[model samples]
Structures are given as C-alpha cells and as structure tokens.
Target chain A: MMQQEEKLRVSTEQLEGGLGLVAAAGYINNEGGQAIADAVNELVASGCRTILIDLEGTRIINSIGISILLEILDRLMESGGTMAFCNLTPTIARTFEIMGLVQYARIFPDRAAALAALGRDG
Target chain B: MEVALTLPLVPDVELIAARAVQVMGRSLGMTDGELESVTVATVEACLNAMEHGGQTCFFVRVNTHREDGGPSLEVEIEDHGVGFDPQAPPRTSPSRILGCVAKRGWGLTLIRELMDEVDVRSRPGKTVVRMVKHVGGA
Candidate 1:
C-alpha cells in the first residue's frame, strides 16, 4: 500500500500590517478535512477578513474537503470578506475549476500575488 | 430473487455492499460497467450507514426481481441505533466528530442518482435505507 503522507499544518504571520497569513500544507481527505476546517475557522475567528489560504503544500482533496472549502467561501461571502488560494497543484487546480469554485474565488500563483491582491503586506 | 446478509457495522460494511450489488446485478443481467457503478454506489451507502448509524450490528436485504420483464433490484440496509434526521441538510463545514477533511455531502445524492429509487427512514432506534436500481433503463 502507498504510505499516507503527513496531512496538514497551519501557521499565522503578520502581513500588510493588518492582514494575517494562514498557510496550509498536505492532502485534504476524510482524514484531514476536519483539521483544515478548524484552521480556517480559527483564522476567521481571529478577525482576519482578507484570508489567504496558501495551498502550495497541499496535494489531494476529496469531496469532503471540497465541501469544507465551499462552506468557508460561503461564510466569507456572507460576511463580505475575501479568501484567496495560492500555489494549487494541478490535480487540485483542476478540481477547483470543475467545481466552478474559481468563478467566485481568486487564485494566485504564489504568496506575493495573493497578498498583493488582498492588499496586505507580506 | 432475494438475498439476506448480515454485516458488522464496522469498516467491513463495504464488503456487504459489494456482495449485495453483485448478487442483485447478476440476477438482473446487468453489464459489467453497470454493475460496477451499482457496486460503488452501494458501498457508499453502506459507509453512510456505518457513519450515521451508531449501532453495533447491521443488516442488508437485497430483493431482486423482474418488473415488466426488466431486471430490478432493491436493497434495504437496516441498523439498530439512534438514528439522525436524513432530511436535514448536511453540515457545510467539516465536522469535528467525523474527523474528515474533504467536505462534499454528496453520498446520498450519489446513491440516489445512481439508483432508480431511494427511500430512507430514521426511527427512534433504527434506521433503514431502501435503494432500487433498474437494469437496461427499463
């Protein structure tokens, strides 16, 4: 059997003076979905409206993970806040496109672009 | 034709699902590809049962027969547990209780889409899922 990789990590950094950085690493599946959701919720609760989800390290996402993401987007949109994704792998990128998530959310190539778009200092 | 199976309400639920679809599909003369889809959907249903039903034992009854000379199968998955409301919308955010990461709530929808008929009942101490699949679009 293929080994299961380490799933997720969340870290925060002060950026653009007011904005906060939330970086996520690893795969998103039934095993890792709850942790990711909690991390995102933590960021939102910390008064971070302009959210930047750094997906440079995430590799896979199952349906459960996608639902969590859509939930986050719905919550943020309801509050008039913004969330952006960065450095998505091809598989995940294609999934986002197929789900039409990119239509409402912004995608960036790297942290610099994401922060710039969010008008935050990185 | 009918087949009765009792399965442990653990990870082994998928095995029962596969067997149910296989026996019923064969009785209905379904193509290999069609049988595969039914098997996948049935397994998903069993997983849902295991996840949602807080029970120790589960049972599955497959009732297969010909309707108007076309093959059809109905599978009843029953569990003895305190059932939850299936009509309520699924949680949008990840559930800490389930401890899963990917968050699409399409398990039931997929089963419904794959099958011809889907019925559910959640009583005080038992939950039953009834699913039917028609062969050859008949």
Candidate 2:
C-alpha cells in the first residue's frame, strides 16, 4: 500500500531590501499550517521584517489553518514587521474577510502586486 | 446514494472527509459555489467534533436526494464528545470578530453562514451537526 502523501509544502526566499517570501502549496491544514508557521518563524528570526506569502498553489484552508496564520500575523505585528498575502482563491479570500484577517493583513491579486505594494519595483 | 465515513478525530482526517464530500457533491451536479459552501461547512463540523466531541473517532454521512422543489445534499457529522448547547450565541459577533485579534471561534459562524440550513443537537457524550445545501437554486 502506498503511503498517503502530505498535502502542504512551504518554501522561502530572501528577497532584496529585507523582504522575505514564503510560498505555500497544497491544503492548509494542520500539517501545512505548521509548515507555514515554522517557515515564517525562521524568516522573522533572520531579520525579514516584511514578508509576503504567495498562496497561488493553495486552495483549501480550515479554521485551524487560519489560526496558524493568525499566530504568524501576531508575531509580525509585535516586532513592528508586516505580512501580506497574494494570489488567494475566491473562497479563501472570502474566508479571510469573514474571519477578519483582512482587517490586519494586506492582500494583493498576485505576488508582483504584493511586491510592488511592499515598495519593490519588480 | 449515501456514503458514510468514520475517521479519527484528527485535523488532517477532516480534509479527507471534506474532499470526499466535495467529490460527491460534484457528481450530483452541484455548482462550484454551492460545493464550496458545503465543503467549508463540513470541515467546520468535523473540526468541532474533534475539538469538543471528546471522542477519538467521528462519523460523517453524505446523502443526496431530490426534494419536491429540487435536488439537495445533506451532510451529518457526529462525535461522541462532551457536547455543549447547540443554540448558544456565537462567542463573538461580527464587530468583535473584526476588531479582536484572535483567530479562533469562527468555525461555527462560518458553518451557519455558508450552509443553507443547519441543525445542531448536542448533549453529554454526543454531538451531531447536520447541514443541507440546495443544488442549483433548489
């Protein structure tokens, strides 16, 4: 029997000007949520104050996943840093609004828009 | 056709149940938006069962039927956990939900908002959430 593959993956990149990008793919459940939280923690520890999470590859996010995202947001706000989300699906976007995550975090249509809003030219 | 699944009270298992429901809804010709609503509601229900139902495993039942007016889907999630008042007011309001900085307690609200009809019954050692979504405006 084949083992069930984990559904979430997280990868990070250090952009210029102290910006950090954390890209996630697959469902944002317990496993995926923890991966994202761990990635953001590592980036913040390395002095990446401005972080952008690209969620184009992600689709479904449950309440537990939302909680994990909120943890990351709280941490960023505490350190005077900022976080943004890009490429959200319509369902996830509405979920964010209903959960009031949009109140604190910025959302862009795509990674380029988020990067631009973060004061990057490209 | 009706299908029932028993899964462990774990977060990842919730995803598996939700995906199965989504596939069933799609096969019954549910629209994307309707399917999404059902999927979200199912996930929320499963999460509640895991957190509050106090049992190691839960059950989910998905059934499709044609009402007099149209086709519909009904999903039932049950857990053998310590149950609470199903009619209790949401812990947070929209205002507080927007202003407050916490990321919890939105599961019930989302379940009520997304599904067309929701019925919850709870007592000690048993909690069940039943939600219905009418397909294609039915």
Candidate with top DockQ is 2
Tens digits of per-residue lDDT for model 1, A1-122: 11234346667665653465678776564545566667767776777776777876664444456667777777777776777788886546655664556766789999888777678332
Number of the top TM-score candidate: 2
Q: After best superposition, candidate 1 residue B32: deviation in angstroms?
A: 2.7
**Model 1 chain B lDDT-worst window of ten:** B92-101
- Interface RMSD (Å), every candidate: 9.2, 4.1
lDDT tens digits, residues B88-133, model 2?
A: 7773434543225566677888888788888989899888899888
Q: Per-residue CA lDDT of candidate 1, range B17-130, in tens? A: 575678778877887556655664566667666777676667778887786867787888887777867797633333331223345456665566557788889887888889
RMSD after CA superposition, every candidate: 9.2, 2.9
Clashing pairs in 2: B53-B81, B54-B81
Residue B7, model 1: lDDT of: 77
- Candidate 2 whole-model C-alpha lDDT, 0 to 1: 0.81
